[model samples]
Every structure is written in C-alpha cells, then in structure tokens.
Target chain A: MNIIEVRNLCYAYEDDEPALDNVSLDIAAGKTTAVLGGNGAGKSTLFLNLNGVLTPKSGTMFFEGCQVTYGKKEMLELRRKIGIVFQDPDDQLFSASVTKDISFGLMKLGLTREDIQERVDRVVRQTGIGDLVSKPTHALSFGQKKRVAIAGVLVMQPSVIILDEPTAGLDPQGVSEILHLLQEIKDSMGITVIISTHEIDLVPLYCDDVIVLDKGRVVFSGTPAQLFAEPALLRAHNLRLPRINHLMNILHNKDHLAVDTSASTISTARASIKNLVSAKENI
Target chain B: MSGIDKYAYQSKLARVNAGTKLLFTLASMAVCLSFSSVLVSTLTIAVMSAATLILGGCRLRCYIRLLMIPFAFLVTGTITIIVGRISQPTQALVSIPLLGARYGVSADSLKTGVIIFLRAFGAVTCLYFFSLNTPMNSLLSLLRRKTPGLFVELMELCYRFIFVVWEEAGKIHTAQASRLGYDGFMRSLHSMGDLVTNVFLRVFRRVDRVTAALESRGFEGNFELLAEQEESSRLLEGLAIAATMFLIIIGLLERLLT
Candidate 1:
C-alpha cells in the first residue's frame, strides 16, 4: 500500500524557476525508499511538500488515501505522521540537552508526561544515544549529532520519516551505523523510511525502492534492481552505479560471464557467482 | 564560549534545580557589590570559588585560568582609580610627573581601589558559581516560569544560534586561511570583510532551514519545550539560604564594626 501519493506536483520560489516541476510519485508503506538526485534537483522541496512544511504551487498530494488540505488542522495532522530530519543536524537541534531536543516534538503533541518519557526513553535506547542524552547538543560530534537528530524524529512516532541526505557528511562507520538503525526502524516499527542521498552505494544495501529526480521532475521510480539496470539513465542524472554492481556489469558485459548483471547488491552478486561456479563444476 | 557550555553540562550540580543556584548567585552578587568592606568581599569570593571548584566539580586549573582573564582587565581598571592627579602631596605614597601633570597614588585612593577590586572579583566568582552549575536549557526553562515568554524565547534562540554561527564562522575562517586570506594586511582586511558578509548571509539561509526542520516536527509559532525533570531539593535550598544569610551576617557585622 502507498502511504503517500502525489499527482502532478509543482512548486516554485517567488519569481524563480520551479523547484519541483510536475513531479509525481508514490512512496510505499513500510518500505525504505531512496530519493536520488543531485544538488538543486528539488529533493528537499519534495520532502517539504510531503511533510506539508511548504504549500505546493499546484497539484494534489494524498497521505493515507486522503487529499492533503494544507489547512491548519490537516497540516498539523500530516506533519505528525511525516517527520523530516534536515541534512544538517545543527539545524534541527535547538535545545542544549540531547534529551530535551528529542522531546521537543513529543511535547508539541500534548502527550502525557509519562507517555512522553516512555517514548523518549524508547527512542534514546533505539538510537543508542542513552549515554549522550545528558550531554549538551553543542558538545556532540557530528556523527553523534546526526543520531540525536534521528532520535528526535523517531520519538515523535511518525508513520513516515523523511531524511534529506542522511549519510551526506558521515564517515563510513557512521554511515553504516545510521543505515542499520534506519533499517531496524523499518523492520521493527513498521514505519516507512524515505531518504534522499548522494550515496548511491547505500541504495542497494538499505533501500527497497528508488526514485530519481532531475531538474525538479521525477525521471524514474521503481525497485532498486530495475533502477540500476538503466545505467545510462543513472549517468544522465549525475549518479554512479554502486562499485559492486559496476564490477558485476563488467563481468557480464565485458568478460561475457554467464551471470545476470541485474543482480546488483553484494549478497545477490555473491550468490550469482556461487551458482555459476557450481554449475560449471557440474558440467 | 562553547568551552564554558561544555563545563556547565559536566558540572556536578547540573541536575539540581536552577532556581536554587540562581537565588544564591543573585544574593551573593548583591552582597558583594553593596558591601564596601574588603573583608566581606574576600569572604564572598572564597565561598563562591570553593563552591564552584569543590562542589560544582569544575577543574581548579580551568577555574583559575578563566578567572585570570577577567582579573587582568579588573587590574587595568583598578590602576586608573589607584593613581590620579594629586591635589595634596602629603598623602602621596608615590608621585610622578607625566605630561606636565603630577600623578600620584594616594593612601585614600589605594584603599578605595583595593576595595572596589575585591568587590568586582567577588561578583565575578558568584557569576561563575551560578553558570558553571546551571546548564542553559534548564536555566531557560526556569526563566520561562518566572519571566516573560518572549524574553525567554529570544534567549533560547540566541543561545542555540550563537554556537551555530560560531561554528560557521570557524569553518569560513579556515577556508579563507587555506587560500592565504590573512597573509598580508590589505588582503587580510579584504578577506575579513568577505568572511563577515558570507557568514551574515549564511545565517539567513540557516534560519530558513531550521524553520523548515521545526515545522516538519509540528512546531507552531510558540515553542513547546519539555518541562525539565530535575527536582529541587529542600536540603539544597536550605543550604543556599544558610549560605546567603552567612554572607549577609558577615557584611552586616563588618558594617556595624566600622
């Protein structure tokens, strides 16, 4: 089931070119979706529209099958379900203490003190930020700050969380940890996760669905396997194939190995190679 | 600035109620400033510094180092009051002719300068005692209950954004320096102008991004901060009151004696 659906969405700044032009896509329920785009590709604009932070210039958006009204009550309702963690953790963390920052959103919901405490504790534990929660936000490392930012959103119990470049400035270890945390949220909590990132390599490992944007328009939307098969399209949009997938492509196309290039991830490529080698031995 | 914030969060009294600490600080500062007695100011400074270093868990070396920075300025200020154009040479401890004027340190002026210096130092120690013990978020929360909401809101934003802008400025300075932006006088001035302008511009962009992030999390025009969970201890309150009374008694006694 689609949790969010947009039709012919168009958004633009004042007297400027469209930031999002005739964009339309469906974000699947309870699945990880990667929104791939280069700089100025309207990925953030689309996220703002999804969370109802900005009113789209034209076109309609539907969340859970109801049209988004952009009214005060409806907007609040939409925002409660769709949380966006901005690319910069500093932008999101306004409170000094990590616990206070995480609870800011929960407090807005007017939840009971016990309920807010329970949610805050659960999220801090889930994000593995329990020890850091007592520290000041300004004292956190960049990676730690990112985790706190994610915890802040997760505490809100959103049905869908949108992350703009979740792994943009993280080290490899930080990136791996964040992706696994997001994956756990998707599997355990059944929350739909959407991330727009330039980290093409992480898409196959963590994302179930892929949507590509170019010049403020949706260029492609499909499963990760289907998206990677069109290498030319990926190149045109200023994206590169994951290194493992590129190696598999070379083996299939250049080396003429009897293996499917469509198997693009590490696990799948390993399985494909194992099958081909075993088949050869039998022959 | 961020260093002080770090130490504040790590202070042993961080989890205590901010109100008690604030009350003690205000009372101490008032006593320190009102009492012209050098002995009372000395007592105030000793009590506040011991509270900060021993009870507040701030490192002694850092405490002394931070104190020295403002203490140096205080010395410069005291010097102006200590030495002046002398009307009577009889009272002069030392006298010098500078630019056709007789400058001297009088017995009366020395006494006044010493008292004022100690008084200001006592006030500084009291401020350090409070801030090092109370983290800004909890303090802001306390302010919300006592002061105007708008004023507290402004303070909260300013506190958060100051660090953000400081970090951005640091990064911009590094970028400029990598290209030798500060190598020469003329070029350094030009680079500094550019750096300031760029940081000013980035602040606006940063604000828009932060506003969007806040809105996505369902923030309305008003802030909805979580109520701080730190409990005020009756014992701690009693201790603070006792200490303030002690300082007042000492000040009053000194006043009576004189």
Candidate 2:
C-alpha cells in the first residue's frame, strides 16, 4: 500500500521558477524509499510539501488513501503523522538536552507527562541513544546529534518519516550504523521511511525503492535494480550508478569478462564474476 | 561561553532542582545589591565562588580565568570613579594636575568606587554560580514556567543556535585563513568583516529553515518542556537559606561597626 501518494505536485517561488514542477511519486508503506537528486533538484521542496510546510501550488498529496489538505488543523495533524528529520541536526534540535529534543514534538501533542516520557523513553531506546538522552545537544558528536534528531521525530510516532541527506557528514562506520538502524526501524516498527541522498552507493544496500528527481521533476521511480539499470538516464539527471554496478559494467564491457553487467550489489557482482571465471578458466 | 556551558553539564550540582538554584541566585543577587557594604559584597562573592567551584565541581583554575573576564571590565570602570575631577584639592588623597585642571583620587570617591566594584563583581559571581551549575536546557525550562512564552522561546532558540552560528563563523575563519586572509592587519580586518557578514547571512537563511523544521515536528506556539523533576534536597535548601542569613547578619554587623 502506498503510504504517501503525490500526483502532479507543483510548487514555485516568488520568482516563478518552479521548485517542484509537476512532481509525482508514491511512497510504499512499511518500506524504505530513497529520493535521489542533485542540488536544486527540488528534493527539499518535495519533502516540505509532503509535510505541509510548503503549500503546493497545484496537484494533490494523499496519505493513507485520503487527499492531504493544507487547512490549519489538517496541516498540524498531517505534520504529526509525516515527520521530517532535516539534514542538519543543529537546525532541528532546538533543545540543549537530547531527551528534551526528542520530547519537543510530544510536548505539543497535549499528552500527559507520563505519556510523553514513555514515548521519549521508547524512542531513546529504539534509537539506541540511552546514554545521550542525559547529555546536552552541543556536547554530542555529529553522528550522535543525527541520531537524536531522528529520535525527536520518531517520538511522534509518525506513519512516514522523511530524512534529507541522512548520511551527508558521517564517517564510514557512522554511516553504516545509521543506515542499519534505519533499516531496523523500518523492519521492526513498520514505519515508512523516505530519505533523499546523494550517496548512490548506499541506496542499493539500504533502500528498497528508488526515486530520481531532476529539474523539479520525478525522472524515475522504481526498484533499485530497475532504476540503476538505466545508468545513462540517471547520469543525465546528474546522478550515477552505485560503485558496484559501475564496476560490473566495466568488467563486462571494457574487460570483456562475460559477467552480468546489470549486477548492482557486491554479492551479486561477486556471483556473476565467479561464474564468468569458473566457466572460462583452465589453470 | 562555551567553556562555561561545558562545565555546567559536568557540574555536580547539575542534578539539583533548577528552581532552587534559581531562587538561590536571585536571593544572593538581591542581598549583594541591597546590602551596600564591603563585608556583604565580599561575603556574596565568597559564597558564590565556593558554590560554583567546590559544590558545583567547576575547576578552580577555570573559575579564576572566567572571573578575570569581568574583572577586566570592572577595573576600567572603577578606575574612572576613583580618578576624577575634584572640586576641592583638600578632599584629594592623591592629585595630578594637567591642562590647568585637577584630577585626583579622593578618600570618599575611592571608598565608593571600591564598594561599587565589589558589588558588581559579587553579582557577577552570583550569576556565574547559576550558569556554571545549571545547564541551558534546565535554566530555560525553569524560565518557561515563570517567563512569558515568547521571551522564553526566543531565548531557548537563541541559546540553541548560538553554537551553530559560532561554529559556522569558526569554519569561515579557517577557510579565510587558509587563503592568507589574516596575513596582515588590514587583511585580517577585511577577512573578519566578511566572516561577520557571511555569518549574518547564514543566520538569516537558517531562520527560515529552522522554523520549517520546527513546524514539521508539530511545534505549535508553545514548547511543553519535558524535564524530570529534580527532587529538591532539604539539605541544599537549608544550605542556601543559611548562606542568605549569614550574609544578612554580616551586613548588619558591618553597618553597626561603622
């Protein structure tokens, strides 16, 4: 089931240059989706529209099969259900303490103190930031800050969570840890996850669905396998194939190794290369 | 500022109730201002220094360094009060004549300057005690209950984003320096000017993004701050009360002695 469906969504600034020009896509429920785009490709505008931060000039957004509205109460209710973890944790995290930052959303929800605490505690445990909850936000490392930012949104128990450039500034270990955590979140909680990233290599490993945006339009939307298959089309949109997929293409074409050029992941590439070697070798 | 903030989170007294700490600070400040005696001011400074350095677990070396910052400003202002034009040379403890005008340090003015300087320093220490013990989150959350929502929210956001701006300014400084931006005095000034403007622009843009982020997180007009109730200790309250009473007694005794 599509958790969020946008049809011909359009947004323009005062300059009349479309930020999101006739964009349309569907985010499936309980699955991980990645939105890929270059700078000024309207990825941020789309996310803002989905959260009702920006009112779309045209088209419709449907959440759980109902059309999304921009009315005051509706927008507030919509935002509670479609939380966004911004790219910069510093911008989103206004409270100095990690637990308070997580509780920021829950505080406005009119819940009892005990209820808010329970939700904050659950999210702190889920994000594995139990130790960080007591620490000040400024004292946290960048990766820790990112986790707290995500926990802030997760405390709201949103049906769909959108993360912008989730892995923009993390080390290799931090990056993998965060992605694995996100995957865990999707699997365990059944919350729909949508993230926009410039990191093409990670999309295949972490994301089930791929969305490519270019010039404020949805260039492609499909499974990672299907999207990466069109390397030329993706490059035209200023994105590239995953490193493993690019390697597979080269070994099959330039090196003439007779391996499957379509293999996009390391395991699949390894299998194809092993097949090619085993069949032809006579050492 | 950042160093003090770090010590605040690490303070042993951080676990104490913020409201109690706040009350203690405010009461101490009132005494320091109202007593108007050298003994009272000295007592205020001594008590706050001990509270911050010993009970708060702030290192004495860092505390001394932080004090020097306010000391520098107080010295200059106090010097003006001590050394000024006197109507009568008879009133002068020391006098310097320049340009047919007399400037001197008088006994009465010197006494006044010393008292004012001590009072200011005592109040500064009292505040240092509060800030060095209570983290920004706790302090702001406490203020949320007593202050108007708008002012508290503004202060909360400002406290949160100040570091963000400071960090950005730092990066800009390094980037400019790498290109010989500070090679000379004029160049350094130009680079600093650019840094400020850049930081200002970044702050302007960040305001929009921050509001959007907050709105997406279901933020309405108010932030129902979630803070665990810090059990107010009877002993701590007793200690605070005892300190205030001690200051008042000493202030009265000093007045009697004079």
Candidate 3:
C-alpha cells in the first residue's frame, strides 16, 4: 500500500528554478524507503512538500489515497499523520528541554496530560534517551540531539516518518545507532519510514526500497537490489554502487568469476562468494 | 559551559522549586535595597553569600569573584559620594588640592558612601545567589507559569539560540585563525567583517529551517511547552520563609536602633 504518493510534483523557491520538477514516486507503507541524491537534488524539498510545509507549484499529493488539500485544517491533519525530521537537529529542536521538545507535537494533538506523558515516556524509552529527558537540548551532543529530534517526531506517533539526511555528520557508531533505532521503530510500530541520504552503503543495509533523485527528477524507483543492479545508470546520476556491489562487479569483470553483482550488503556478498567458491570446487 | 550555567547545574539547590528560589531572591533583594543601615546591608550580603556558597554548594572562590564584578562598579560610583568640597576645613579628614579646588573626604561623606556601597552590593549578591542556584530552563519554566506566553516563548528561543550563535561564532573564528585570517591587524579586521556576515547568513538560514521543522510538528502561531516536573518540599519552603522573615526582622531592628 502506498502511504504517500506524489504525482507530477513541481516546486520552485521564489523566482528561482524548480527545486523539484515533475517528480513522482510512491512511498510504500510500513517499510523503510531511502531517497538517494546529491546536493540540491530536491530531497529536502520533496519531504517538505509531502508534509505540506511547501505547496507545490503544480502537483498533487495523496496521503492514504486522499488528495492533499491546502486548507489550514487539512494541512494540520496531514502534518499530524506525516512528520518530517529536518537534516539539522538544531533546526528542529525548539524547546530547551528534551522532554518538552518531545511533548510539543503531542500538545498539538490536544492529548490529555496523562496521554502525553505516556507517549513521551514510550518514545524516550524506545529511543534510549530516558536519561536525557530532563537535560536541556543545548547540553546534548550532536548524536544525542539527533535522537531527541527523532523522539520529538516519534512521540507524535505519525504513521509515516520522513527524515532528511538522518545520519549526516554522525560518526560510524552514531550512524549505526540511528539506523538501528530506525529499524526498531519500523519493526515495532510498523510505521512507514522514509529517509533521504547520500550514504549509498547504508541504503542497502537498512532500506527496503530506493528512490533515486537527480536534477530534481525521479530517475529510478525500485528495491535496493534492483537499483544497485544498474550500476551504470547510478553512476550517471553522480551516485555509485554500494561498496559490496562494487566489489562484486570487480570480481565478475576482472576476476572472471560468476559472482552476484546484485548483492549490496556484506552478508549477501559473503553468501554469494561462498556459492562461487563451492561452484568452482565442484567443477 | 558558561560560568553561571556550570554552577547552576551543579548547585545543590538546583532540584529545589524555582518558585521558592525566585520568591526568596526577590524578597531578600527588596530588604537589601530598602534598608539604609550599614548593619542590615552587611548582614544581607553575608547571609546571601553564605547561602549560595554553603547551602547552594557554589565554590567560595567563584562567589567572591562574582562579587568583585559589582564591587568594581560600586567603587567608581561611591567615589563621588566619598569626596566632597570642604565648606569647613575643620570637617576635612583628608584633603587634596586639584585644579585649584580643595577636594576632601569628610567623616559624614565616608559613612554615607559606605552605607550606599554596602546596600548596592547586597542587592547584587541576592541576584547572583538566585542565578547561581537556578538553571535558566528552570527560571524560564517558572516565568512561563506566571508571565505572558509570548514573552516566555521569546525568552526561550533567545536563550537557546544565544548558545547556537556563540558556537557558530567560535567555529568561524577558529577557521579564520587556522587560515591565518587574523595574522595582521588589517587582515583581522577583514576576517571579522566576513565572520559577522557569514554568521548572520547562517543564522538566518537556520531560522527558516527551524520554522519549517516547527510547522512539521504541528506548531500553530503560539508555542506550547511541557511543564517541567517541579520538586516542591514543604520543609524547604518553610525554611526559606523563615530566613526571609529573619532578614526582615534584622532590618527592622537596625532601623529602630540607628
């Protein structure tokens, strides 16, 4: 099922050229979808449009099969169902305290105080930020602030959560930690997760589907395996195959081995290599 | 961390109710300012400083250093009060001839200066004691309850972004220094101009992004924040009230005696 559908989306900032031009894609429900693009590829703009933060110049968006409207009530309802975590945590976090920041969204929902507390507590535990709830947002580290930012959205219990470059500027451990939390969020809540990133390697490991954007257009939309298989197409868009897929390509082309070039993850590549070795032994 | 922020987080009274601290600070400041007797002023300074250092667990050296900030201002102000034109040479305890005028320190002028100086220092100490023990977040939360929502909202944003702007400025300064942007006076001036312009641009962009993020989370025209869990102790409140009464009593007794 499609949680969010963008059809012929076109957006321009002020008098500038279109940031998103005739872009269309369907984000699958209850799955992790990765939006891949380089700088100025309109990933952020698309996320904003989906949440009604920006109205497209000429396009239509459907949330759960209903065409989105620009009415104030309709926009608020859409925002309640769709939350966007900005690329910079500093931009997203307005409250000084972590608990208060997380509670901001719930307050908008007009939930009872007890319900708000319960939701905030659940997200704090889910994000593993129980200790930081009382701490000021300014005191948090970059990684911790990112968690708080995610928690702020997660507390709203949006069915579809969109993140703009969620793992940008994180250390290796921080990236893994955020990805792990996202995975947990997906499995436990079954919420549709959409993230935009240039980290080609993380897409295969974490995302189920891939949407490739280039020059403000949807160049490719498919599963990670299907997307990685077209290495030449990806290269033309200023993107490269994941490290494992690149290695598999080298093995097939230079080493003359029948390796699976479609394998994008380490474990998949390992299995493919084992199969190649066993086939050679049998021959 | 900034100096006040560091102590505020570590202060033993940090967990105390912000209302109690605010009330105590204001009441003490009122007494300190209202009293003209030197004894009441001296007592106010001593009591507030001790409460901050001993009860609030602020370091003595830090408290004394903060006191010196107001002390310097008080000295400059009190100089005029201490020095007077001697109408009677007999009244001059010490006299100096400057620019064909005789400037002298009289016994009466000395007493007035000392009293005013102590009163000003005492009022400042009360404020320092309150700020040192209560974190800005706590104070803001307290204000949110008592003050207008818009005022509190503006204060919250300003407080959070001040740190952001300071950090951005620091990063720009370091980047400039590494590239020898500050090697010469002229270069340093040029670098400063660039830094200011870049910081403003960055902060402007950040504000726009922050607005989008806020909207995504369902922000309407006004900001609604969660109330912090306040720790209120009746025993503490009683002790604070008693202390304020004691200070007031001292001030009254001094007034009666002097």
Candidate 4:
C-alpha cells in the first residue's frame, strides 16, 4: 500500500513565485525513495507539504488513505507519522543539549520517562553519538550536529522519515557515515524513508526508487535503473548517472561497446564491461 | 582563537554542575541582600572575587575591569546619594565628599548606596561565574530542572530568540557597513529605522521556520527532564545544597551577633 499520496499539489510563497506546481507522487510503504532536484526546484517545498508544514495552495495529500487537513488536530497526527529532518542541523537542534533535543519530540508526544529514555538510548546507540549527549549543541563538529539532528527525529520513532539534504556540507567520511546509518535504518527497520538530496551518487546506493523534480514538477519517477536508462532525460534534469552508468555511457560511445546501462552497482558494471570486452574479442 | 582557548573560561568551570553554580550565586545574592553594612558588603565582594579566582579559574583583575565597564552607574548612583538630603547624622559621622555638592555626606545614605552597588556587583559576579563555567546547554537544562514551567519556557524562548535577533542585527550591520551607510553618527541614526524593520521581517520568517521545524518533529509543549541515567554529568548537586545551608547559618549568626 502507498504510505503517502499526493494529488495536484500547488504551493507558493506569499501567493506568488510558486515553489511546488501541480506536483503529484505516491511513496510506497517500507521502501526508500530519493527525491532528486537542484536549487529552487521545490523539492523542499514538496517535502514540507508531505509533513503538512506548509498547506498547499490547492490539492489533496493523504497518509494511509486519510486526506490530510491543515487543522491542528490533523497536523499533529500527520507530524507523528511523518518526521522531517531539516537541512540545517543548527536550526532543528534548538535545545541546549543533545539529550534535550532528542527528548524534545518524545516528551511532546507525552511519552513516559522510561519510554523517552529507551528512545534516546536506541537513537544514540544507532547514531553513535553517545558521548555527545551532555555537550552543548554549539560545541559539536558540523557532522556530529547533523547526526544529532537525525537522532532527534529518529528518537521520535516516526513511521515515515523524510530527510532534506541529509548529506549536504559533509566530508566524504561524514557522507558515508550518514549513508551507512540511513541504510542500516532502512534494512533493520521497516520504516518508510524519503530523502531529498542533490547528491545523485548516494541515491543509487540507498534508494529503492528515484523521483526527479524539475522546475517544481515531477519530471521522472521510477527505479534508479529505469531513470538512468535515459541519459538524455537525466541530462535534461541536470542529473548524472551513478559512476557505473556513466562508465557504461563512456564505454558505449567511445569504445563502441554495446552493453546494458542499467548496471547500478560497481560490481555489476565491472562484470558487464568484462562480458562486453570478451564478446568483442570473440568477434 | 583555537577551540581550546575559545572555551578556556567555560572549560575550567565545567567541573561544577550548572545547578550548583546557580544555587551558589543565589546564596551569594541572599547574603549580600541581608547585609546593610559596607564592611559586610565589601567582605562579600572579596569572597566573591576570590571564589571566581580559586573556584571558577577566572582572574579577579580581569573581571573587576569588566565590572568597571558601566562606570556611568557608579558615578550616577553616588551623585544621587549626594543630592538626596537625608540621613543627616550619619552624613556628619562619615565626612566623605558629597559628590561635588556642598551638602554634608550622609554616612547612612552613602553606606546605603555603596551597599546597593556591592549587591549589584555580587549579583553580577554570580552571573559571570555561571556563564563562564557552565555551558549554555547545561545551564539551560539546570534551569529547566530547577525553574518553574513558565520561567523555564521564557528562558528557552529567550535563548532561542537571541540567535534570531543576533542574525537580524548582524545582517543590518553588514548591509549598512557594506554601503558605508553608518560611517557617520547622524547617518547611523537614520539607518536605525531600516534596522528595526529588517529585524522584524527576518524574525517573522525565522519564527515560522522554527515553529514548523518544531511541529514536524512532534514537539509538544513541555520539555522533558533528562533521566538520571542519561545525565552522564558527574558534577555534584549535593554540594550546592550543603553550601546553601552553611551560608544560611552564617547569615543567621551574623544577624544575631550584630
């Protein structure tokens, strides 16, 4: 069943300069979806709409078959189901200490002290931020702060997790750590994950499906393999294929090798290359 | 500055719990307020200065220099003592200058003004020690734990709003400075209107974003107290209670003897 349903959504800042225009998409249950877009592409607007942070100018959004209303009662319920990790960790981590920030949501949900502690413990252990609990948010390194923000949302145990640019402004190590953590969450738990990012490289590794947003609209929606198959479409959206697919394109054009460009992983790309080269030698 | 030096003051004071430091300051204020004699106030100042140096790792001279920052208050408060023609006998007893006035010094009034100033200093030192030693987060948590609900929320909101206002002020300053708009004093005054408008607009947008962020994460109204097991901080809260008790006894003894 589709976990999230959006239909003919439109949003604008101050009733003009539309951010999301006639955008519609459905997020499947228990699957990781990566929303890809550039700056000002309304990816954030769409995500915000999903959590009902911003009421759409016109359209319907549903979670678990119930249409989402902008009312306080509905929003509170939507918020519990859809957790958002904002791009800037500094803004989301308004609490003075790591523990308070993590407990902020759970405490609001009226969870008992024991339940709150268990959630905090589980998230801190998962995010590997045990030692940073007592420290002030300002004292942390940028990556540590980002993880703390993620841990804050994770501790709430929301059903649908939406991360806005989770890996932006991170060193390679930090990016890998975040990706590894995301992968672990998806694999270990059955929670639905929707991450919006400009980093195309990470989508193939972590996402089960890709939704490409362009000029405040859904330009493409499919598996990474299906999306990468059309290099021209990828180029139109200013998106790149993963390294493996990029290699396939280079080999297909320059080396005159005919091979499937759907190889998403490095290992598959290598095997496809070996097969293509052997086939050419035999001919 | 390097990270270590940046937090040099706070890092050294980090050994004490924020709650302890707050309680100690409150105790200091109570004691200072209980005394009217200049000698007692001075002794409290001396003890406070020493405590900062010995316990808080802050230098006395540097902090005293900091206290001198609002030198205008000292000048103004003393001037008020001279003008208020009260406490005549005490004035004759203490033959100090009547702050450039021909009026005879009122020892009681001068003593009273000086006590007020010393009380101010004691309160200021307490605040300084707390800020210097305890991290903002720890202090905030301590406050959330010890303070009333309305007060805790006010403090948290204030702490959050500080960043919002800082960014607003900084942006206005930058925009003005970039255009060489505020170089002259008169021109800077003119820009104040723009500064106020900009801050309001920015604050509105930021508050909306912050509220949205809070709601999206399921933030209910109340802030939860971190569990005892989760507090990882080893600072002793018991010491604060014990010290507060000792100070109360000292205050009672001093009151009875005097």
- Top-DockQ candidate index: 3
Cα lDDT of model 2 by residue, A1-283, tens digit: 9989999999998777899989889999999999988999999989999999999999999999999878999999999899899999988998776777787777767799999988888888899999987687777899999999999888888899999999999999999889988998899998999999999988888889999899899989999999988988987988889999999888778988788877888888889988877887855
Fnat across every predicted model, in order: 0.74, 0.82, 0.77, 0.53
Q: TM for chain B in all models?
A: 0.89, 0.85, 0.94, 0.68
Expressed as tens digits, the lDDT of each residue in B1-258 for candidate 2 is 468888998998887889899899999999999998888999899999998888888998999999999999999999999999988889999999988888999999999999999999999999999989998878877877788888987887778777888889999999999999999999999999999999999999998988899899877777767875566777778989999999988888888888
lDDT of 3 by residue, A138-177 (tens): 7889999999999999888889999999899999999999
Task: Identify the superior model by DockQ, candidate 1 or candidate 3.
Answer: 3
For candidate 3, report its TM-score. 0.95
Q: Model 1, chain A: how large is the TM-score?
A: 0.97
Question: What clash pairs does model 1 have?
Answer: none
Candidate ordering by DockQ (highest first): 3, 1, 2, 4
Q: How close is candidate 4 to the true structure, as a TM-score?
A: 0.77
At residue B236, give the lDDT of candidate 2.
Answer: 70
> RMSD, each candidate, Å?
2.6, 3.3, 1.9, 5.3
Q: iRMSD per model?
A: 1.4, 1.6, 1.1, 3.0
TM-score versus the correct structure, for each prediction? 0.92, 0.88, 0.95, 0.77
Q: Give the distance in Å from residue B189's predicted Cα in candidate 4 to where it truly belongs.
A: 6.0
Worst 10 residues of 4 chain A by lDDT: A133-142
> In candidate 4, what are the lDDT values of residues A146-172, reduced to their tens digit?
899888888777789999898999999
